[model samples]
Target: MRVLAFLDGTLADPDAAHIRVDDLGLMRGDGVFETILVTDGRPRELGPHLDRLARSAKMLDLPEPDRAAWERAVRAVLDNWSGGAELALKLVLTRGIDGDPEQRPTGFALGMEIGAAVLRGRAEGVAAITLDRGIDPGLAERAPWLLLGAKSLSYGINMAAIREAVRRGADDVVFTASDGSVLEGPTSTVILLRGRTILTPPEHIGILPGTTQAGVFRGAEKAGFATKVEPLRVDDLLTGDGLFLASSVRKLTRVRSLDGTALPAATEAHAELSAAYEAEYA
Candidate 1:
């Protein structure tokens, strides 16, 4: 536990703050959350992230979050933070106090952390491992009632997978289905490129619809490249000309190797597109 919590309309450390035993969020992970990059005191893509979080909360049958209150809470945290050229802000809204899993609480908890950003800017890119995890085909396209697209706190499995990848000498892990089709990274979106055309798995395939991915497509199109979304296979990736992982924090990281085999790093065209998107956001 770290000292990063905004509880009950005040700034307090999580370890020092007291929560009710009936808090369903703590008991059953009954909550929705969003992590945004707060640069120069402004949270990027705040609107879309909050919209997704609200959708996720509704899917879980949790009480609707107070949008204005949540926004104010984040602003309060930012206002108190002293320094950090760049910071990460996390907004979590869970059913605050409830014993029965069948009942929703009237309030939610908001937490945030101010820390150094994970830097990933080098021509020598990161290595990755692909995990063959199975995702239900139905949940791939339409958001499921249970598998809400909102960010949940139950991320033990994802953290374990990342640890496994790091133990294997990879900086990150790319998740694949049992059928060998590509999905996404543990926290980023996957993209494959051939020549100048940019390709990524459709979000309908149970992949997280990434904000950075959309920015990449827009930048690529502006730079005169054909951007498309399609189902990608392992062979397609191995044979593809280049590979990249897109995210708000990481920006764009080239996948230099995959499953012990080398992948063509993002070429000049890819770098140009990435820089364009970064410039737009910066």
Candidate 2:
């Protein structure tokens, strides 16, 4: 697949040697990022993604991103894309080369095709395993430096947890707090449906406030479905009428099984929510 990259103020080949070796984003993962799905060359929920990126940058003490610059870069990459297929536009901002007294932040945008695995998970649903995140749900408010709500580049642990789940024969992971409250997926937001009510863990639980989930909730409300933010536990998942993962790229994906136990088939609810989510970006 052809991939494009925008570095600083210029668009370049993604494989080009542009990033410095001392970049803190690569060295220490000291950065923040946002990914937006582009369909038919139009970016989905661009404003909210940029808003979240700015918030994450502030939380990380990184330099503020130039939204106009990023927008120009996104347009350049999308216009240059050869395929008519959907693309994943990722914006990355790193605290520039380490030890640089200026501490300028490195910003870039990359465009690539959405992964087949992500598409498959959306279509076929996913089997998930619950993993302890090793922290209390209230930790973010007390420990801001932990960057719980910030979408940082430091995803080693999250990726490792997913790998561990794969090793255990699961497609993905739903991270829970030390208290066993369902938090979120490693790369997605967790949502549960009971009858016509749509529920997700409250943002106070230290999970990233999901842009897509917010859109889904808005759509759900307009569609006459009750939407709420509530604490969820393992038992809640087991007993819920339906479970799903929501994100910008993955959209709304059903959870077929959790920890090897089959979940209720909420196909009708899933279809309704999926349509509602699609309308938000359409």
Best by TM-score: 2
Which ten residues in a row are the worst by lDDT in model 2?
Answer: 1-10
- Across residues 1-282, which tens digit of lDDT does each residue of candidate 2 receive? 555656434667777697899999999999999989888888988999999999999999887888888887777788788875688889889998999998988887888778889999989999999999999988989999999989999999899999999999998999999999989998999999999999999987799999989989988998889998999999999999999999988989999999999999798889988888778767
- Cα displacement (angstroms), candidate 2, residue 65, comes to 1.3
Q: Tell how far residue 198 is off in model 1, in angstroms.
A: 1.7
Q: Model 2 off-target regions past 4 Å?
A: 7-9
- How do the predictions measure up, each by TM-score? 0.85, 0.97
Q: Which stretches of candidate 1 lie above 4 Å from their native place?
A: 1-9, 100-117, 120-124, 139-143, 146-148
